[model samples]
Target: MIPAKADIEAAYARVKPYVHRTPVLTSSLINKHINAEVFFKCENFQKMGAFKMRGAVNAILQLSEEERKAGVVTHSSGNFAQAVALAARTLGVQAYIVMPSNAPGVKKEAVKGYGGIITESLPSLEDRERAAVEIKRETGATFLHPSNQMEVILGNATATLELLESHPDLDTVITPVGGGGLLAGTALAVHYFGNRCMTIAGEPFAADDAYRSFHAGQIETNTTAITIADGLRTQLGSVNFPIIKELVTDILRVEEAEIVDSMRYLWERLKIVIEPSSAVPFAALLRHKEQFRNKKIGILLSGGNVSLSQLPF
Candidate 1:
């Protein structure tokens, strides 16, 4: 079963000692352009530069003494990799990370900085998973799914929980969907905390598995992950999909150009750095601006871990 409201509340309390209560910021210019008030949950300012820290911390905190002794392992392209590594380090647990070779060098460096033992894999979901499984089997470490684990989902919800606490009047929440962890968790947060707020997801058109999965009423896989939003390349998983399919209002997708332009657009206006993945939701909001007319919107700026050399600008 999906996590109940009490479960999410408890997770928030459990994570407080480990994570930051990130601020929810608003831009009047963005509101003017979209014809609606918008609140940006600045998880980009989060520790390790992403919301994945919340989940990774929660997932590790709940582990038994024996599990912690064996350490933790996961496979992620960027944000979650850094999150897991940092969380494990914070808790004095060994972290075995399987990362795709094509992941940003900055992220790879961050993982190493957090003391994660890295096993490089070819840039594919299969290779990443295989490497993680091998490490888990070899070291007897507990494997934490970057997005599919229930503990991770509940941990992810704390971001939106904090958002609704700051701005309770929001009518809609927009999340960038990658494997549905944050989207599913955000939907649950709105369901439990918001005053009838609806949840939507923004995805890259090139890696539109979540968008396709939402409409098709089933899980879909992307054969090719060629988008600039490197963080959102993963596919939806069984654990988060049910909550997403039921509670999320829609999945809005944008093209590569929109993603890059919106990334820079917010950078210029908000004067804050956000990755291309963070810009997807803003692009979708502007693309479908008419749908949210007069609505108060909440967008989660997922992360800010970009390689300086690989700036898409």
Candidate 2:
């Protein structure tokens, strides 16, 4: 179910103590090049190096005392794995994470650092979910899907809620659509918070299910996700798809090279270290510059958990 406006506000309040109020930033150079005033909500600096922390914390905190005692479990390729681990540790609950064997070493290490018991699975979403189900059955831990749960969606909205609070007049907001959680939350936030501000999602051409889903008016899954933006690889969820189809203004696709160039541009120009997934929306904005001409737009720089050793550049 879609969260009410009050639920989004309450979510902000609930996660406020646990999460960082990430800064809203801008680049004069980016503005000149795109001919639009762009505000970068730097969630790369968020706790766990991503916005997933907001959802992770909110979902875990909503569990009953009995549920928390049994602990929580999730499947993720990276950021959400670290988020649940760290949030569970901070809240004094055990977390068991089923992570793909091929997940980035940096993220796997972070999950361990946060005291999550790790289960290795094959490098497919299906395998990851299966492993998580096994862990949940064995440990009696609650399963927290990274993007589908309603509580998680409400939590993800807080990031854009903060963005809208800071810039109430934003003409549009863009997010990289992976599992559709963030984009759904952003759309809901814009609907309830913004003054006619629209929502758009940037997606990789390689894993463009969200794009196809939006146009085809149904949920679509990718057989193979081969993009450098690791975080933007998951398919849309049932819980968020209805919200997205109704509220999102458009979905734009960008090539892999464009994703890389946009990432490098942010690195050099914004002088902020952002992961490739964080740059997809920026690439979309630049690619469709004519649409945003002179408008005030906001882009959420999603995360910064890249391993410097493996950068494409």
Candidate 3:
């Protein structure tokens, strides 16, 4: 079920002590470049260096004592793995992460540093799921989807809730789409709290299942995951897709080059390090410049987990 405003509120209260209240930053130069007043909710500075911490903490905290004893398992490429690992460590629970073998080395190291036991799999969704299931069976771990659980979705909404609280007058809010957790949560927050703010999603052209799904009125899978935004390669799940379809105003697709350019631009202009997935929204704004001209928009900078050796710029 889609979590209600009350659920989001409770999640925020539950996770408040654990996660950082990441800042809302404005860049005059970016505003001028886009011809709009832009506010960036910098989740790049969040705990575990990403917004996933909120969801991870919320999910872990909701577990029963018995369940906590068994611990939790989840499959993720990077950010969510580290988030879950850190949250579990903080809560005195074990975390088992099933990661693709091709995931960035830095991110894998971060997961280990956060006390996660890692199981590597081939870079395929099927392989990742199989590994997670095997781990769950062996360890009796509760399987938590990185972005599809109700608690996780509400947890993600807290970031948008915080954003709208700080900028109630925003006409629109934008976030990058992957498994739809953050975007769906942003939609719910805007629906419940904003003064008529609409939610738009920025998606990569290479991993454009979200854009296609938004238009097709059903979940769509990518034929190939070739995006530099490795975090965005996953398809939408059953739980978050309906919420996204109903509440999101639009999904804009940006090319790989645009994502890379936007990532570099944000780092150079705002002096903030944002990964390619986080840059997708800004790239969309640039692609549809005239549509949002002279409007107040809020962008969720989703995360800052990037490999220095693989800098797109």
Candidate 4:
């Protein structure tokens, strides 16, 4: 098991100098509309255009010089691909990126531009992992799990640390649940801070594994996930599952239409362009406003990588 508080604190120290101190935005417009006092963690402004960079950089920096020389391997829907690619390039190591054929072209180009070697595979996380494993055997590369490793979790936790530090009075934190890295990390931070802040995980209505898993008491990863939030399509991983089971309190599901509209809300109201996956938390709030009304809620915006033309407006 990962160290609960101290290790997470050390993780902040280890990766702080390398990552951006991402800003938080509180909007009165959101508060009036949703009737909730809201704080937004703008991770869309993070390096490589998402929160994955925090994990990727911290994981890369933790490696020994020999390990760095040996290089790294992983798979992603998009953001983590760019994160690992950019981090690996910075460390003068190779990044073997396995992605689905259906991944956004913008992300594919960004990965290649960062000098990452790209491999196309089926969209399933298992298939992507299998491909990366095969490449690892062939190239002697260390497999860096996108959201399953302790280091990545610690890196993800920093966002919460920053948020709570800036907005000490936040009563709750809402974030999207993919492989559970962000949720796990955020929960750890909330717990360590000795704050009663509730950690709420959000998922697409179409792919509600995390929501189901929370109720089932154990994650059911065998089923295929179906959602337009391609970034959140992965099942919970070994490291994240236990942490989430222990830390997360609840899960919310949001519809596809709400996701798109939430993305638009960010673009119009916040003047920020965010992807569908990142919009799920806001969509959850919009869909179930009464649940969060009059409460001081913190929303973690997971990323900003959408193709403008893809918006179904």
Candidate 5:
């Protein structure tokens, strides 16, 4: 289930001190093209190179003293694993992270560098889940879902709260969706603030489960590999499906090439290094320029966890 307002609020408090209050940036050049005042909540500056830290810290900290002592486990392509490992380290708890065989070397090294126990699996949630289960059975560690858990969603909401609070005049908020925790949390936060901001979600055309599910009025899962946005490869979770369907005003699909181009643009023009996943939203802006014309838009740059030389563009 989507986290309640209280739960999200509690998570905000729980992770307040641990996560970075990433800055909001604006560009007149971008505004001229989109015909909107664009504010970016750059999560690239976030700890562990993404906003994942907020949720990881909140969920890990909320564990019972016994549970913390027992330790925690999770799976991720990159950012969430690093977030969990860093959070667990902060709390003096052990963490086991299952990552895919195709995960970037930088991310794998980061997970290990943070002192996480690493397990490799096929590049699918089913494989990751199976590995996580096996690890749990062997180690007796609590598992933290990358996106499905309430604590995760709640922790994700803190970014939205910060965005809205920082930009009271924002009329729309755009975020790239993967498993939908960020979008779900953004939706809940926008609703609670009673603000009229339209929440628009972006995803790569190659992997747009959240978009399909929103349009179909049901969760949809599929495996298609066609995007460079590795962080956005996952389909929506059952818990995140309904929240996104009800709350997001629009779901925009961006092409893979555009994702790469936008990543380059962010680095060259904005002087911000964003991952392909974070660049998807900017790609959406280029594809549907008219839709966002003449409005104040907020875009969440979800992460900056890419090696400088490994950029696909």
Candidate 6:
């Protein structure tokens, strides 16, 4: 069942002590460029340096004492891995993370630093799932689907809820679509509490399953998501797809070069470090600037977990 606005509020209260209430930042330069007043909800400054921490904490808090003792397991490429690890550690629960062998070294190190037991898998979704299952079997850990669980979705919605609460007059809110947890949650928050605000998603053209899924009225997949927005490489799961389809106004697709340009602009203009996935929404706004002129917009900056050694710019 889809979680309601009350569920998101409960989650916010549950996780409020654990997660950071990240600030909403404004960029006058960016506003000038888009001709709109834009508020950036800086989840890049969140715990574990990503918005994933909110969901991780909420899911962990939902576990029973026995389940907490048995621990939790999930497969993720980066941000969610660190989130689960950190959340579990904070709650005195064990965490097993199945990460792609090709995941960025910095992310892997962060997971390990958070006391996660790491099991490496091939960079395929199938392999990661298989490895997570094996870990659950071996350790009796409860498996958590990183983005598809109700608790996770509602937890993610709190970020948008906080944004809208602070900026009640925003005309629109945008977030990058990966597995669609954040977008689905944002849509729900806007539906329940916003002042006639619309929810939209920005996604990579190279990994555009969410965009396609929005139109197809069902989940979609990309054979290979070769985008620099690594956090957005995964396909939307069943749990998030329906919510996204029903509430999101549209999914805007941006090219890779545009992603890089937007990332650079945020770094240089706003003086804030944001990953490529975070840049997708801003890139989409830049691509369709005419549509949002003079409107107040909120953009969720999803993460800052980038590898300095391999800077895309």
The CA-based lDDT of model 3 is what? 0.94
Backbone clash count for every predicted candidate, in the order shown: 0, 0, 0, 0, 0, 0
Write the residue-wise lDDT of candidate 5 on 212-242 in tens digits. Answer: 8888998887668557888888778877777
TM-score per candidate, chains pooled: 0.99, 0.99, 0.99, 0.97, 0.97, 0.99
Q: After superposition, how far is residue 281 of candidate 6 from its true place, in Å?
A: 0.6
TM-score for candidate 2, residues paired by index: 0.99
- Which candidate would rank higher by TM-score, 1 or 4? 1
Residues 138-251, candidate 3: write the lDDT tens digits: 999999898888889889999999999898999999999999999988999999999988999999889999999999998889989899998898989999999998999999
lDDT of each: 0.94, 0.94, 0.94, 0.87, 0.87, 0.93
Query: Compared with the true structure, what per-residue lDDT tens digits does model 6 show for residues 1-313?
Result: 5667789899999999999999999978888989999999999999999999999999999999999999999999999999999999999999999999989999999999999999999999999999999999998999988788878988999999999989999999999999988998899999988999999999999999998888989888999999999999898888888888789999999999999999998999889888889999999999998999999999999999999888898
RMSD of each: 0.7, 0.7, 0.7, 1.3, 1.2, 0.7
Clashing pairs in 1: none
Per-residue C-alpha lDDT of model 4 across residues 1-313, encoded as one tens digit per residue? 7466888788889778878888898878888998889899999998888899888988998889888888899999899999999989987989999999889998999999999999999876668989999999999888988888889988999999999999888788999998888888888888887378889988997888888888898887636666788889877877888888887888999988888888888888889878889999988878888988788999999898877767756
Off by over 4 Å in 5: none
Residues 162-244 of candidate 2 have per-residue lDDT tens digits of 99999999999999999988999899999999999999999999999999999999998999999999988799988999999
Candidate 1, residue 21: lDDT: 90
Task: State the weakest 10-residue window (summed lDDT) of model 1.
Answer: 22-31
In the predicted model 3, the residue pairs found to clash are none
Clashing pairs in 5: none
